[model samples]
Target: MSVELNKTLFNSRLKLIKDAWNNASDSEEYGSIADVGAFLVMAGDPAGEDDPIRKGTAFQQIKGGDNPIAIEIIPQAGAKEPSNDAIPRFVQAYISHSRVGSLLKETHTGKLVKEWEALLAAANSRPELVEISPAMSSFMAVKDDEELKIVRTAANLTSTLLANYIATKLETILDKEAKISHEDFSAQIEARLGSGEGDDAKGPDMKVWNKNPKLKDVDWGSTELCYSPIIQSKSTASGYDLKSTAESSPDMIAHSGVFLISTGIRYKGYCANMGRTIIVAPTKEQEEIYTLLLGLQADLITNIKDGAQIRAIYQHALSYIKDKKPTLEKHFVKNVGFGMGLEFRDSAYLLSSKNNRQLKAHMILNLSLGFADLVDDAGKKVGAENATILTEGVKSVKDTLFFEANDEEELKSSKPKKPPVKPLTNGHSASPVKNKTVAGKVLRTKTRSAAQEEVLMTTAAKIREHQIELHAALQAD
Candidate 1:
């Protein structure tokens, strides 16, 4: 399709999400008072058959049938106490449950009962709108019509807030170093959401956005994580992105400094993953490095085609650079680009194993291929890469990842662009990482809990087994 059509579709999808937020379910429609009342009385319904107390009379009914896809929500008074819900928001175990159960929960029953149970038990708040339910979590975990809206909304919101953060936090960082603390900076962003830090506000448990290091520190400002490995968007750094929280763990979280990346924005339960690499003044080396990384990303993504073999794409990436030159290896593209939703890197893994898997219909994958070269620079390196979606007829997911460089007009126009070839070595800067973002905390991120790593190893084994099965089936045919 034409570039105009591609952009038009992306904007349209984004607008729908904003509409959903503007028209969220109101208090009465959510049946908050009624849901709370019913649960309370189930414990003790003393009123015989017609007990007025047994049924909720506190709220009015919302007219339905008149409106399809009706959603109800209640903005209860800020909770005096934040209840603990034993939901597994970030556990790897839940990843195993996604495939079939996710589809079932959408038009049928939900997958995580424990998460929903938490809300059912929060009676003290008399919270007409208790959380800890399948609603928001389901949106994150599943990719359906409604869920897609949330993701698109989140992406747009992220860019909007990013301007505010860049002006308020990052842009003024070195100049106002003594004046701004991390906590103060974070709260500023919170306000834009009609939410902020108070004694009882929710934790920044936005796991899907994939928190980076700047969020985890106090004295140091951080960069935002652009392009989660799973979603496959290009990064401001111009280098490819790091993969899942499950993979990076505490080891990677240590490097999060001046994180210019963003968790995008959240609408209802859905959120988008947007990020930028944080840099101070522009150096000739820095500028050149950025161009190289970004150019590779642009070229590779635009070339994506029908029946495109993974190995062919892999070879094309390597060809861009004559030498190894921190080459775009086949393994990087193959292993990254997963399904986007509540969690990062859900449903799919990008690489093919022993079996050569072809792209299927409606599968959204992140082709997060990026690289850095230490060539000719004194020492510092840079990165560039992005994500694109594969659909039979719809526009590519690449539209969402492209930005005209909000304020970098001079840089945009001025370019002979660098030579495509650079030395392939371990000399350039290291790749980006994702995991354990603690804002204002002094301690280091805890290493990957051995338990979680064990689960990952087990998952790896299962993938191997599945590959064998696929290979056998393919061979039989």
Candidate 2:
């Protein structure tokens, strides 16, 4: 597919974001000063193929996992207990109640409504197939094979657009602001691509939206305002004058952390998951911390065996980091690995017990670890990553190297920054990182963890138990 068509998917996602933003805000909405509005609704991982989530409804129904609706999606709004994550109510309503219009087949709503009513009745009455509107039955049924391709195309296109944006502009965005034009950017990207599932898939030939006379098309959804701390927009001068503004705000720090959680840009149906932490202006201490964390991350990824006990990875990280800072282990900790697919946090936390679950092959996961100043991010003991996954292979974030355009000046005018061999420093806390290798791609190794089949069998059982509970919960009122 041409990059332009992929951008079209982002354009639609932008519309959806704008709609949600208007729903939330009543004040001047010229990019809302911060990207909080945008971030909350940003896409996580896409729903699995087998997952019943065709559109936004599944996110509403589950209200768990990384499905934009997850309680931990954004550490909960106005939350006093930072440890307790809750899905925002407005977000929930918009996703579930309102998005039914966006996600379900637009032409099939009235019938879907009737079918929902019918299904409600059937659920209370009987499980046997009963005569019903085709829309409802189909909605409740597995997605048609054709629909899957279209939706997947739509989604992958979005991911490609967002990934390109992040890859090309992420650093510039973080350091400075830029004019973002969803319309122009979308048009540019989608114009060339065709619609399909693979990287080379073609985007829709014509505009995929409607052209009726009575109503404004608003056919595709979109983002809230494409606002990031460093602007990543593609707007025009006459339409929306662009600016590249960068500043430090408490909001930026807190939300940037959250943004890192959902860094993979949302598009079409397939979601992307990637995150990186860059200290805007790093102190000597912060630089050291980044080095240590990056090194520890390397160790974690290298040790991720297909069947290794979950606890073993944790122990390796903890012990290795302890080799650097023995006393650092005294502080609180989170999960080191987790499954990633349709959601960011898929059925696990960063600090999960190996007794509860074990790593497995073919599971896409984000193995995260966060360290604080002998404390946490919030009053609740500064926060750090709490998850990783047990998988045979690893994906490196540095596979596509990004160099700051301004990095030339920074390097020429400044001292040559030496990277830490490993993040194992003793005693006091090392500072946070200014530049980072996001996820496993930061490392340049192809080593895999040892076989851990025994632990895998046990963890699989626990996952099954959790999944059964989840399915029942979804079926519940």
Candidate 3:
């Protein structure tokens, strides 16, 4: 991709999203498409006996593809690196900075504001399309917090929908619910994205796409299982790509009862990412590691705030690994988390090193940690292990955490009371909390009132119903 071509494609896609969003206020097809993500999926070349997957695909989505949304998964193109990768990054950078950059730079005043005004002027050169009475007012309107949120929602929707698609597809194949081969599965997923069945206006769900296909005469036992996983391609920071690949590890998929999914998408120009380790049936050891990872994640999320030290946080995770499980020493990636925004990777990062940078307010951080390969004594990976014994493989958990200016400032001004605690010789605090006893009992009462029980049951039922509806929607597509 050349510089000029890259710019052209980016502008075109950005225009597409913007037109859709602006028109969403009136048109049914656009429907709040503030964010979008496009990616390339390369499967090993079907034409050759053995060739690096020459076949790849790229997909774009708006607002989770509900309604008549703008989404497409172009096949035969975007297979090569540096081709489809640039689209999402450019989308994120342009939208994020365009909308939020002013808010971020309000501290500097004048220069940034003028720059934005000029850009707005260029964007809406013909006042007829978007009336600009006062340039500053128009710019400010574009930067409205609510509008910013819509963009964030759009980006998040893109990622969430993609994740759901992958999970649903995997479940279909693994459970034998759908007799779909690897080659056809990609097309199936792509067609659903393009169906625009997300909105009620588009008609009932699952009606847009062909649900029933003629079963081909083929021997199921002879065919190999095909899977095409999705990954995020670009980030503002160069090192932050979670690249999607055409090929997948059969051993890991077969032996592992769990899979870690992580990816990001951009909407209205901002980028959002999500990651989770989905567990099927698990052994005791696997359960323990999973719990530990969750605990570490909790610690990071609670401690995260403006002015927190990145190096210190990373060191804390490392220290936790040392104290909890020394066997994972080798698999510890230097980074536990990093900044996320306009680009997949931002300027600040979490790592154990001597650095002076402190976290700033409004920074989007991706907190994650996991073991790459935990091989049991048998030398097989745990997730896809051959025997009941432990195995070598990968496991991880990640979540997006943000630092808000208002929350941090409120916490500082409140000056909450704290109990006195002594520091250990190791420079760690042992802040043991005193337990509160009720009715001279060590544990809290377990009995629930009828009203409370009813409320809980109702909530649970609603959640289950929602899950069922979502599953049906995905499967139907």
The most accurate candidate by lDDT is 3
The TM-score-based order of candidates, best leading, equals 3, 1, 2
**TM-score for each of the candidates:** 0.37, 0.37, 0.40
Winner on TM-score between 1 and 3 is: 3
How does candidate 3 score on lDDT? 0.36
Candidate 2 at residue 470, lDDT? Answer: 21
lDDT (C-alpha) at residue 77 in model 3: 26
In terms of TM-score, which candidate is strongest? 3
lDDT of all predictions, in order shown?
A: 0.31, 0.34, 0.36
* Per-residue lDDT of model 2, residues 62-90, tens digit only: 22122232223444334354433233333
TM-score of predicted model 1?
0.37
Q: For residues 199-302, write the lDDT of model 1, one tens digit per residue.
A: 65553333312333222321111122322222111212233333332111111111222233433333443334544443332344333444444444444544
